[model samples]
Target: MPAPAISFEFFPPQTLAASFRLWDTVQALAPLGPRFVSVTYGAGGTTRDLTREAVATLHKSSGLPVAAHLTCVDATREETLQIARDFAAAGVTDIVALRGDPPKGSSGFVPHPDGFASSVDLIAGLREAGDFNIRVGAYPDTHPEAADSGADVAYLKRKFDAGASEALTQFFFEAETFFRFRDACEKAGIDKPIIPGILPIENWKGAARFARNCGTRIPDWVTDAFEKAERDGREDLLATAICTELCSELIDGGVDALHFYTLNRPELTRDVCHALGVTPKADLKNVA
Candidate 1:
């Protein structure tokens, strides 16, 4: 099979030490020649400014296209559109539009009085604001808030109809999970590229918690394997093998692109990409 095209996702740093980690992450993965890299916003859009700064800086200095995460959470419509305009002015035209999570201690998402109320609305506004290549989230398992998996698929179709050009699924534990979701999406008449998101398990505990929060189903076998691996001090080795295997399966199943949620750490992601035959190319020397 031909090597799959890839991208990486990083979140904006919250501290000086985190800044170092983010840069080191870039240095390690940029050489892999990702088609684009995205920076995420913190919950409730708390890291809006930081995301903007990181996106612009990376676009200018890294020789890689950057996608900024734009959320409709706490900001007004005018404020959010202005941010989109600012990103376009900074040479960024790709956006991952989302209806972000509620702030800590909040019950659920509550849009500001003057804000776009949903991700569909956010995508429409971003479309009006600029010529952006918009991306949106998809749920392989039913979204925590959805009535069922079918509802999630229908809502994803609405997001595309609203203006998004692509959908990136939430990370799941099994390749079958993504394949079923892909088939469902096709049946629902959504034809956009649905990139599978891969999260290399660096900390099994943390990943399990994340899966719960995001409504991703984790197989019992995976939990058992991680438990055994942890007991044997083989966490990293097991992680690399599982992630590389998952990518290989996806490629074999006809997926042409993959997105890695690096969580601001790159070693496992780098190794997984290398195992997939995405060898470092000389073009990255310019970015270095």
Candidate 2:
């Protein structure tokens, strides 16, 4: 049988040098033809304009669909919706709505007093405001603040119940974890597609720190794989195998789509897609 389709995520660059890197990555992976590429919003909406610019450029130039990430961290609900309306005006038809983290150095997520309270709220508000293909974030194990895995799945169902069209999960290492999460969602009565988020551990140190803070597990096997690879400076090669194996396992388990966190780098993601037998499609007309 055929494997799942693929999507990718990128962050809007904050510097000219970073912008070049992001465009380079986009160029390299654009050939593989992701179903859609999402650009992330910075903490506290710091990069909102930059994100808008990047998403617009991708939509206009890359011939790939773009989903702009929106969050209710620092903006009010009206403000957030205005951004959504702006995206609609810019010709974007999809969004990844998230309850983003607090401004850097804050202890935890503290919602803006006038903003949507959670991702479910954001999803609902977006649905009410426009006809968008909304995607919400899901935690397979548990959100850092979730009481348990059951609670995590329950919350995800709530977001879906609020009219989210799809879910892109937090990056996870264990295929069993995702399978179990999928099962839990099924039992909870959610039938929407839950795309597994895949992050190739190219920077082991940085990924470890972020994963620890975000409550994503770094299994012993994963660590050992990277540690062994570190000794030889072959992270790219090992990343290819690890991500390929993980994706293959998911495909075998019945998933139909993947979302890649590209970190503004593309070779690893491109290689992974190539390994999975997915190829980029040719340019299509802009939505506008």
Candidate 3:
């Protein structure tokens, strides 16, 4: 099969050391020629300025297409749209529009009095405010706040109708999960591109917790394997193998694109991409 089109997700750094790490990550993965790389916002839009700075710096320095994550969490409607307009002014036009998580201690998402209430609303506002290639989130498994898997599909359709250009799914363990979700989306009359998100397990404990928090079901076998791998001190080896296998399976199943949630770490993601025949181009740009 042809090498699939690939993208990556990164987060803005909050500290000087973290800034170095983020640049290192970009340096490592940029050579792989990702179609685009996205920078994420912190919960409740806590890293709004950082995300904007990182997106701008990467756009200017790295010669890579960078997408900024904009959320309806703590900002007003005008505040949010102005950010999008600023990104456009900087020559960055791709956005991942989201209804972000509530603040660290909050019960759940509560829209700001003057903010866009939902991701769909945010997408609509972005559409009206600027010319952007907007991406929205999708849930292969049921979203934690959603009524069911079907509800997730219905909500995604609404996001598309509101003007999103694509959907990037929450990471899941099995290819079957994505296939089922794709079938459901098709049945629901949603015709947009849905790219599967892959998280190469960098930390078992953290990944498990994140999976639970996001309503992604972890298979018992995955837990058992990680347990054994940990005992044997082969966690990295196991992680690479598992991630490569998963990507191979998805390609075999006819998936033509993938988005990796790199979590600001590039080793495992780079290894997995190489294993899938995504190699560095000869003329890799200097990210320094």
Candidate 4:
């Protein structure tokens, strides 16, 4: 099978050391010729300016399409739309609109009094701001804030109806998990592309914590395999093998594209992509 089209998501760096890591990550993965790369907003939109700076820098320096994450967090509606306009002025035309997480140390997400309420509203506002290729988040597993997976699919369809052209799902362990979600979305009449998110299991403990927080179901076999790999001092080997297997299964199941949540660490993701026949080419031409 041909290598699937891929994209990567990176968060804005808050510290100087992290800045180096982000740059290193970009250097490592840029040669793979992704469809696009995205910069994420920090919690509560605290890194709004940083995300913008990173997005602009990546677009200018790497000559790659950069998608800026716009969220309805603490900013007002007008302020949010203005950011979208600024992105357009800067030549970044791809957007990932979301209802951002609430500020740290606060309760669950509480939209600003004057801000758009949900991701659906954010998508609609972005559509009005300019002619952007909009993408929204999806959850194959139940979102922590959602009632169930059915609700997640329904909301993702609503996001598409509101102007999102595609949806990138949260990372899932098993291929069947994503296939089930895709089937549900199709049955619900969603016609947009639904790209599966791939998270390479770099640190099992950390990934498990993140999965729990996001309501991503973890199978017992995965936990056992990681435990054994750690004990045998072969975690890296195990991680690369597992992620490549997962990606292969996805392609077999009719998935045409993958979106990686790189978490500012590129080694595992880079290695997995390479092992799955996504190796870099010396020629700087796009290939899917």
Candidate 3 whole-model C-alpha lDDT, 0 to 1:
0.95
lDDT of 3 by residue, 1-288 (tens): 688899999999999999999999999999899999999999989999999999999999999999999999999999999999999999999999999999999999999999999999999999998899999999999999999999999999999999999999999998899999999999999999999999999999999999999999999999999999999999999999988888888899889999999999999999999999999988835544
RMSD of 2: 2.7
Clashing pairs in model 1, backbone N/Cα/C closer than 3 A: none
Misplaced by over 4 Å in model 4 are: 284-288
Q: Per-candidate RMSD vs. true structure?
A: 1.6, 2.7, 2.0, 2.3
Could you estimate the TM-score for every candidate?
A: 0.98, 0.95, 0.98, 0.97
What digit string (tens of lDDT, one per residue) describes model 2 on residues 27-82?
99887777899999998888999999999998999888999999998889999999
Off by over 4 Å in 3: 284-288
Query: Between the candidate structures 1 and 3, which one is better when assessed by lDDT?
Result: 3
lDDT of each: 0.94, 0.90, 0.95, 0.92
Location of the lowest summed lDDT over 10 successive residues in candidate 3? 279-288
The global Cα lDDT (0 to 1) of model 2 is: 0.90
Q: In model 3, what lDDT does residue 246 have?
A: 85
Error of 3 at 240 (Å): 0.9
Q: Point out the worst 10-residue segment of candidate 2 by lDDT.
A: 279-288
